[model samples]
Target: MSTGQVLDQVMDIDEVDLTVDTEVDVNCISKHRSKVHQHFTKIENKFQCNHCKKTFNIEKYGCTSNRLKHLNSKHPSKVEKDQTHALTQKNVILQAFQKQQKNQSEADLQRLITRFIILTDQPFVITEAQSFFELMAFGKTNAPAIPSADTIRRKIFAVYDEEKLKISQKLQSAPGKISLGADCWTAATGKSFHGILASWIDADWNFQQVGLDFDILNGNHKGKSLAASMFKVMNEYGIASKLMAITTDNASNTDTMFLELQKILSEN
Candidate 1:
């Protein structure tokens, strides 16, 4: 054939191929776009699957192929639902997950509130205050309701007991004897009380101090009375045998208290 005829044939074939390619692309775009979008949401520039919440980049992938592939492989049944139904289903699933997470965090949140109250010296009734509720709501939109004041008091005692047990165990396992400190004072309410603290060196050679007791001392703050109160705390913690030294103010009664403690120790 002559060159012009050959060139004409080549041009005709190229035109047919281009037309077929263009038609196929248009068909794919029209048919797959709605189907793919049914199970996915376009957020910003990414398509996130409603069922799985997996995001596909719109810039790199042009929004349909990756999403369709994700639907077919990961969520085959979800692709058949209409757009509105799929979106509602996604919201339901997400809400359920968030609710479950919130429920799980409630105990932790309560403990944190207890710690906050203790650290701030706030009254337990603070939990019942509307201002506190507003503060909590301001911090978290779905914050759990604050427990009643009585409930908070019980939690405080429970935490105290748990920590006391832990401290008792630590004192029991201490490598060295525990040093005891005691002070007798009258509270603002004119109630006499004895406060006892314990200091010890741990197996790790770390010095640890813990408040052991702050019990009401009904009678006099004399030597024998203070000795008995301090020893009671030591016996309660199972640490009377681990006493290294007693520390107190240089009152004449403190000397007698030490003598009384020695007599008691010798007798025990």
Candidate 2:
């Protein structure tokens, strides 16, 4: 059997919906033609032969018969016929794919771990639990190494910063005025924090919302104090001038907060 046929059996290539969560590259390759792929360079919608620099369109499912015919007719000497060498070459390709799959799986595991810790408000040390290790080892023989508490902390902060950057860019490009809603609450530890959310319609007419700030309230939760903190968040995103409206609970402090914000806006 050809290397492509063997790869098809190993990977079990099947037609799948693109809408579903799937690795299109691994599962959608035409007939598992990694052997042909190794000799050709992909150029946009076509693959270019490395030897002749001629490009060919991929048939419906990634068929590379034209490329194979070219190689057989024009580069016959390069084609190996010995089954033993063909098997070794197949192993090499499979090993490359295995290494790539391992790296990809490791990255996905890290992201899942990061999201679990952040969304659950769990401590970074949760990754160090015996149960966590056993859970990772449940199905797989060789589970990827769990990151240390410090590593998890770093990853969390990195993700936070990266997401914040995305939100900032979106806010900058929003088509209409950005509306803001803010609330303050005390955590179980008695430490107070204020969260501000900004919402706006994008150029595509899609409504978008993002948390601009969720930081510790330094001094007091009074109107002036809250106004000061909110101002900083708006200024950081450079959206103070584009503010369409502000929303907060109907409290005496909120009325005072708006008044103070208006004064601050005028002074700027």
Candidate 3:
């Protein structure tokens, strides 16, 4: 909208005095390369003007419309070149997005592979199978290649340890005393298993529960066996001092288990 002679020099954005009353935050722009800022950035739809420091909601008025109005009125030459500059920058931004997307896709692959292994009871080495690679390759995912079985295994263990730590902290930080529920059963394979879970309200008053232990019972389901397993979980999370009550089905052994637990908790 400027005069022809001044507009002719619009090609060089570097000359524009893009200075503001206050500096514009990098987040004030979409995740695109900015000629003026020259940084990777993304902003909320509502942004404050860099020159005026006035707040505007891009969604209510329109995304980028306020920006355009400012550019056209204050720096028409810059506006004249914005479309071309944005076009030139598009390819560069796209390449960056592609690279980021590929990495995220690969991480998702690791999680999916872990879930598949657990749910299907498949061996850890199944990841190295040729059919898995072929199936994933045909899906056209951005993941560059199928991870080796060992890589998937490492990822699974890393994720498990991280989650375990989080659960431990949550139990230790329970807003109130925590309650426990436990169960024991023998599987069709004739292997005995026992599991324990903790339940408590969070600081925000939201009830939450998480399994603290699920392990094979190598010995008979005696009171001593149950007490040992329960003690292990409580000790791991340091929740013995915070335990409010323990719940179990009407089993004779469970009654004995509580008596044994009381002795252990008292001695500690």
Top-lDDT structure, candidate number: 2
Error of 1 at 82 (Å): 22
Residue lDDT tens for model 3, 135-227:
876635355656777987787788778889999888877879999999999898888889999999999999898898897887778988899
Task: State residue 203's C-alpha deviation in candidate 2, in Å.
Answer: 2.1
TM-scores, all candidates, are 0.57, 0.55, 0.55
Task: Report the C-alpha displacement of residue 167, candidate 1, in angstroms.
Answer: 1.2
Per-residue lDDT of candidate 1, residues 60-98 (tens digit): 444367666777788766665545665665555555545
Task: Report the C-alpha lDDT of model 2 over 1-268, residue by residue, as the tens digit.
Answer: 4435556655533443223123334344544334555677766566687878877764432455667777788767656542355777667556655554465466677888999999999999999999988887664444467788898999999998998888888888887899999999888888888899999998988888888888798766788988888899998899987899988888788888888988888888
**Residue pair clashes in candidate 2:** none
lDDT of each: 0.73, 0.75, 0.71
**Worst 10-residue lDDT window, candidate 3:** 32-41
Q: Candidate 2, which segments miss by more than 4 Å at Cα?
A: 1-109, 119-121, 138-144, 263-268
Which candidate number has the best TM-score? 1
The predicted structure with the larger lDDT, 1 or 2, is 2
